[model samples]
Target: MPEVELLLRSRRVVTPEGVRAASVAVAGGRIAALLPHSAQAPPGAAVADFGDDALLPGLVDTHVHVNDPGRTEWEGFHTATRAAAAGGVTTLVDMPLNSLPPTTTVPNLHVKQAVAGPKAHVDVGFWGGALPTNRADLRPLHEAGVFGFKAFLSPSGVEEFPPLGPRELEAAAREIAGFGGLLIVHAEDPGRLDAAPAAEGPRYAGFLASRPRTAENEAIDALIALARRLEVRIHILHLSSADALPAIAAAKADGVPVTAETCPHFLTLTAEEVPDGATEFKCCPPIREAANQDALWAGLAAGTVDCVVSDHSPCTTDLKVPDFGRAWGGISSLQLGLPVLWTEARRRGHTLHDVARWTATAPAALASLGCKGAIAPGRDADFAVLAPDETFTVDAAALHHRNPVTAYAGRTLHGVVRSSWLRGRKIADRGTPLAGPVGRLLERA
Candidate 1:
């Protein structure tokens, strides 16, 4: 038998089969076996018993914006991954846009890796950009091993990363398809946004009106048609409008190669409750009403929405202007995604298995990270010991992210993450100092 380096026994170990009493054995940084709960540890092997706390596969958040390099002040690899560990996320794929020289070229990706390689505290991968000007760079970026490419149909908030026009979008899709790479898009129609009334105040209603659901629905329709015609793999990022769910369902049913993800904010908070001047809740394709949120939940249940991610975009507090129109739009929820989603999901009759599927398994599958998102043997021994019945009140100042701005402040949440393991090593534990910057910079296989 292989020498087990560590044994984690739990009364509630979440596996692909289901949650059950088991002892997970780790050897050489990967899971070695799933033995009975009372299984004895191998000689000299370290053991940690979690009792009834759910031992879940560490989460895989594929929609994070780490924004290192030039935007490190907003969020960097060190703080972002540390925050991810605190939230029970073991792997996160960084989005390309917000960083300086966004990963559109091989050299830019190298620069990003150099900075992140030394600072990350959890496994990190990257997505390359599909900007209007970088069509030729797509194949090179893919060959260099970015997980996929990110494009914006509407204007990206950054001036350098411009949106792809219709022609540019199709050209890029074709180029990516030729290489069999995935294309992830921020889909909000530019024309629809331009036609909407200008938002100029602190009122949440005005901001909601400025970015209507039609913007998302129309953009998704265009992307679906293009995906069907080109036969390229496509993923919709941070889907906020439930009206587009039906079209997404139909696209998938028709064999269009498409998938979609929604964020924790959309599932947990409603526009009706956002107070005026609460710019922290200001994200593009803004959070909608309760009915829309309910539909989003239904979409997840029906599998029209493949996963939930934090979309953990953050900017300096100074950038968060009191006026909703002027503020930079994003929600900083990297450290709160699991608890926030679990608190809401459990209330809706969902189980921990359901939460694991949305936050880990599906997102891992979306990014094609096979070794992640599960507790089975031959997979990375990354796990989160979560006390599902434990509760906590959010306090922004206490979070590990560089910036303490978050929309979840003051809210009570369930499922406190007691500790998180990365590759069989403890990287984070509640009330303990972070272990070290030992995370690997991953490449697509």
Candidate 2:
């Protein structure tokens, strides 16, 4: 093994075993060893000593949208990954849609990867899209090294990426199962949505009513049944309705290969806090009431929810018009998810170890990135140096994302990321990304 090239000592280092005072030794861009916090650095090894700040495994957010190639105005890889680094995210898997080619085929996937290769500031991977007509592309794309396939049960907002009907979704799932590939879904029953009252005008209540919990519950129940029968691994994306927790838990107990993820918006923001016409808060599976948020937290603590990710979707400011009905539905918080999550997690008495699992370990496992996530030997030396007790008020314009628009605009958050290192190289320092893009394009390990 190569000699240690760098050493990081922290009073509180979050590791797979738990949080404790430790010194992490790094060599050849990977973790070499873990020792006591007071361990001395070997000859020729550079050292950084963090007295009381917590050193966490760099977060891995599996749900992010970087609309490059076709919609660079919305967000490109360069700015998006920069924001991710600033927020302590070391690795992210880009969503299939939103980008120009949509990643529905091998060629499209290659195009997006080519565009991202020169721009990403963090290690990035791709997810292929699953449409009714793209059935043949499933295995080929998976073989081409996409992490998984993403399918939507209802309208996908954009005309290019249409949702799959029940039969089409089943076909996609069955096909994915044959090849041992994962299928993640945007679960909202279109029938329930069509039956609900129209969400027109500026009222948040009107928007909330349009995406009822029944939609999520019905969709989840059907997915559970599908997983049980077809024996395919299905991941529920950005789950908002806590009413479906019991069914999800039951499915897990029954040994159905089903997992679910909720976004930071659902965990922190609430409909009551969203004023009328604040379209920035508008997203599909809309943020629910305070009680619903509470239930979601409880579900998270009880292990019913698998992980928390940022569905970091952003659009041009014009696309985010003031009216809730007219504005685009997405939230861009790649630059704020760490603090946003920590602020809420701490209040609930959750430890940094728990945060690391939800944001890093679970996400890495979900995507099957075996060599990343935890601060253990043989893993990439990805670390997020956080002042867990520090506080900061968000200023949208100060963020590194392409557009200065986010739902976390003015909120105060805890746990500021003082620095972030990817593969033993500092990518972000004092909430700013260092010059040059050091990220690499990643495929399935």
Candidate 3:
């Protein structure tokens, strides 16, 4: 038998060097070599040839909320990872909130891994929560291989994972910096939110008014300043306000170790587009106006925004009540991130290469997942076979997410994911259904 276990050839293979016709040779679940597209496959090796479809590195979504172990009703590893594979994401880093006992300690991390090990359909990593009382757990969790620490500048919705105040925020930063760990923050100023009038009723305008651009801007400014003074790395999560792009750019230029990510909901959906009773469009740092969305697109084109991820936070239907203030604030879009981004990105004259870079390359770099986000030698043989020209209308009920509700309920999107592979094994296919859970837990070194 040949040493190469599997060989995949594609006419439009997206590589770091750029898209070209190439054949990938796989051995021991890692990419062994890249040959010409028409190269002959060795004897006794499984071969698959995609004549016109584009081969892309599986996406790495760093911001995902798999509310499992405690709140499995909201979402669990089995459902979430299956949705991930169907959406062409081969690796994910779950957020540390809304789960039972949250990932605030080393023991909690183990509990999550134990539950996720058997159910996940894709490789998974975790982020440790940074609450006021969990300061002592930071170093231990990092040593335990958590990717980083997650904090909020304001009250997190769940009472279990409270937000970090100014003093506590600085203290956490110092502790994490002492160990050279990354601190990812949900930056929304509490004072600004408290000062804004209560956003009651089902009016989308009222909800949008409550979480104004000033709230996100002020919080990001504080984070940038804090990272500069403490000489620590900080990451801004789910950045919706384009008003803060200039400040972030200037700080990055000034050598402050700060990075930012914007979600697909903010980029595609807008405040004007959402109906009053559409609670699914309601998310923290609410989607802004079209002009602001334009600025965000410019930020992506100019490198001000580091990556685009689906902040795939979901809850049961009962949580999505009619009242905007009373309903839960999250968008369920894990299964549609790629096509959603592509539909809009291609409209803006962007190519699949740009999409691959933002969704795959940049995110893997952010989480420091070395083996993921590329189709080159020495990397995992994970790939997303995409028909860039093909299109489909999203059906929420047919999705793999536990809850059938989604923000992309009837949108027609481009770029169909024909198949997704993890470590040379086909885990999900648009045509063939998943056979079993073939995922493993990942850790940061």
Candidate 4:
């Protein structure tokens, strides 16, 4: 009766019918109606039309590394969520490690929520840590609203969160399975990495050689076998080895409860293109050759890769210096995943709808976020209005993240987010958060 609140019309609106001109009605922070361009609006409703821009469901990036609490100097909720808003991401799930106390216990999860309460500008959820010692705390953290649990098969690059051995991994998986929780893993085999040559010097090849495809494939094979025997849901994180794609496909075909994801760096940049000593391009399970990149994209096209979320792990500038052997192995692209993906995806003949599926819908499904991720009745009014054809050069200093260190620093990218709305309210462009914390700690159903 109150004029239905607002109407946002766009030339390209991603919907069940595909991208087309449509006017969406919003009321009480949810989509009230989706109508044709010429349809009448509810009386007195305010309207804003994006002439040539596309209106997409705000991206749900489930793999951001907002190292807050103890490591807020690296990244925090305030800066990370502001970056998310500008990047067209409306919802993000924070990784458990890097933060002090990590999100292993129920008390630690509360510490994270309390720290993030007044700072976040976009909707945020969390993942729990799966340290060997924390498996006993899994059910309690899951019950307390953590989306799922994260573990590593190799060293986690941090002293606080160590990797689990095969037996420890199975034990943790069993605990998670007993609670009906999911286990997301950083699947690089320690044994294979140990067998490989040590990475040294400035050459990217040396670094790439240290973490080979066999490391990923071998670790994945173990995970697949464990998932089948343990009856647990397992997701491989930041998959870079294309050789493992067939194994993943076969496991899925055989009904193993396993899924995998790849980051933007893997899909956009290849080992051939990376210059020696460019530590910014360095990441674990290092970016492989162009042929491998093509295979990773093929995996996405064939639906073997479930999602394309930015594993936006960032650190200080000093940590990402020119020395490849000593620098941190992560990329900071939380605010640029859309444009980076769009630039490469279009050249490869993929659509924005595919981008939406990879960046928004699929990630939400993986995290079990029911109200976020899509444009539909009863869903949160989270949306991104983009000038899909606009191009912009990257300037790391202009970004909202705490550290101005990013791999996309000089590259040009397509797709610009003109505006973003969260639960019927515009943020970043205008207005402060309505009241208290808008993000609710999410849980999987």
Candidate 5:
């Protein structure tokens, strides 16, 4: 018998290597130890044994778009973070756009913190925005503790956060490099975008044609070149076009500091399958054809793609219109990222280890959160007990996000998240949050 604060035992515990029967000991909100199932709990220790369910590390989503402060009606820290907790995500990094004052300056970062400090149900970190006008503010924002800076090479959906041009990209990269900060880019060339046919109507094909793979490839090519020349770290966000994989791979092979993250929408949904007039499936750098989707999975399996995150960018129902061309582009999947990814991954013969690495580990690494993603000593004891084979139909209205609009509505997804624990306490039960918000605002050092 060993003394510990709490013991969570499961027949299938997801470890770094793979799943096995283990008992995890928690003390002072950190995992104090991991022992075999035969290990006995101390006399005063409390233990919860999950018979057939799996004990998994709480997911760390690094690409969520919690449009708070100015756009709280769209999504806010309170609602979004609660949804994350219900979904088994104990940590998430919010994107810097869609809010009134995008987090391009230190003051803007402060504003975000003020809004989120008490509202977050799971630990929330922030990514700052990089616009041409804010080039001078990048260093201070980085020093102020943003995980990284997000820049758009093409027009950001919201006008407040304008995209960075080639010159601006160079300037921003230089500034970020000086401070040793990371820059995550929404890679789509405006030149190619201007050349593509004008988008209008309900045709999914027309929409897909307007944002082709060429745009992604062209933008990545330029960013990779610039990153190499400047010796700066660049991350490509929400990679939907598989045509850019070889270049990304070659860049990594050539020692360029570049990484890419693809979203659950791009991996699971495709343009060909989307019904006409369904704007819920709409997202920027729109989901491509089946072949492209397959290539993206290959990129993930081959290690060309660094990770998978839920770019859980959501808006009001009115914003995601019945007209595909008029709808705001984003997917509301904060609460379904794990299930969606698990359903798809298992279908492809991949293990839960892959899911843990992609959703939990890599995202934490991107945020520079050293103790949040894994189930090991010194790491935070945030975890989930999952019924991997259980199925549930998605009910958008039942979702905890402010807006009930979602692309995954009505879909029968595998892998039910039975309960989510944040720092050794259960925070989720059937989509309702049970805690009084134990989450903190994480500022990257």
Candidate 6:
């Protein structure tokens, strides 16, 4: 028999089949077996019994922006992964932009890995950038093991990573398809947006109106058309507009090989709640109204939206100017995604299993992280011990991210994460000091 290293027993264990009482045995850093809840641990195995607390598969967030290397002041690997571990996220795929000398080439990727390799507290993977100038660098970067390429259809905020033109977009799509890789896009029509009123003020309404849903809808339509024409896989990132749902559903039904994701802010917060001058709530695709939030929920239930992730883009607090339009556009919720989503999801009559699927399973499937997302045998021994009934108010200063500028400052949330384990080792426990760096840099398999 294989040497059993650890055995975790829980009254509520979430398996792919269903939630049930079970004991998970781990050996060689992978799940060895699923035994009955009362099963005896092997002689040499370390046992952790979490009575009544739910044991869930660690979440896989594929849209995090750990802007390290050149942009460590914004958010670095140590801070970001520590925040991730605290939120029950064992694995995260970092977006390629925001960092200086973005991951647009193999050498740049190595630079990031060199900085992150020793500081990461959880498993980290990278996404390559699809800039107009990097067209020739795609395959080499793919072969170097980036999960996929990320491209923006509109101004990317950072001048170095320019938005791809229509011709450039199609060319990148064809190149990515040629290599059988995926292209994840930030879909927003620049033409419509430039024509729309410019955002400029402390008023939230002006910012909301500046980025109307039609921009997202038009971009999705164009992307769907491109995906169909090129026979490539495309993923829409941080989809905040509900009006694009029907088109996404239709395209998927016709087998267009496309998928989309939304963030916790889009699911929980609303335009109606955002107070004036609260620029911390600003993001690229502005959060819509409550009815639109309802439509987004419906889209999730209807399988139009594939997953939910924390687009945990963080910056210095000073950068979040009182002006909504001029402030940095991102939300810092890396350490709060689980509880925030759980609070809203439970209220909507959604079960923990549904949360698991959206937060872990679907993201894992999207990035092809085959071994990282489930509790089944042969999967990595990553788990989150969540106390479902516990509750806490959000305190931005207490968060693990480098900056204390979260939009969830005073919100109360459910599902407290007591501890998180990565590869059979405890990386985060509520009040205890975290263990040393045990995370590995992952490559596409």
Listed in order, each prediction's TM-score against the native is: 0.99, 0.99, 0.99, 0.97, 0.98, 0.99
- Winner on lDDT (2 vs 3): 2
Measured on C-alpha atoms, candidate 6 has an lDDT of 0.94
Backbone clash pairs for candidate 5 read: none
lDDT of every predicted structure (CA atoms): 0.93, 0.94, 0.92, 0.87, 0.90, 0.94
Tell me the spans in candidate 4 whose CA falls farther than 4 Å from its real position.
1-3, 430-441
Clashes of each: 0, 0, 0, 0, 0, 0
Task: Give the per-residue lDDT digits (tens) of candidate 5, residues 1-445.
Answer: 2348799999998888788999999887889999998789876789999987988899999998898899999999989989999899999999999886788888888988998898889998999989989888888888889999999988887889988888988999999999889999999999999999877788888888899889999999999998899999999999999999999999999999999999999999988899988889989889999898999999999989988999998898888766777889888999999999999899999988888889898888878899888888888999977899999999999999999888899999999998899888888876788868889888895
Q: Candidate 2 vs candidate 5: which has greater TM-score? A: 2
Error of 1 at 72 (Å): 1.4
Candidate 5, after superposition: displacement of residue 116 in Å? 0.5
lDDT of 5 at 422: 88
lDDT of 2 by residue, 125-144 (tens): 99999998999999999999
Find the 10 residues in a row with the least total lDDT in model 5: 1-10
Error of 6 at 245 (Å): 0.5
Which residue runs of candidate 2 sit more than 4 Å off their true CA positions? none
The model with the greater lDDT, 1 or 5, is 1
Q: Tell me which of candidates 4 and 5 scores higher on TM-score.
A: 5
Task: Pull out the clashing pairs in model 1.
Answer: none
**Model 4, residue 47: what's the lDDT?**
88
Supply the TM-score for candidate 5. 0.98
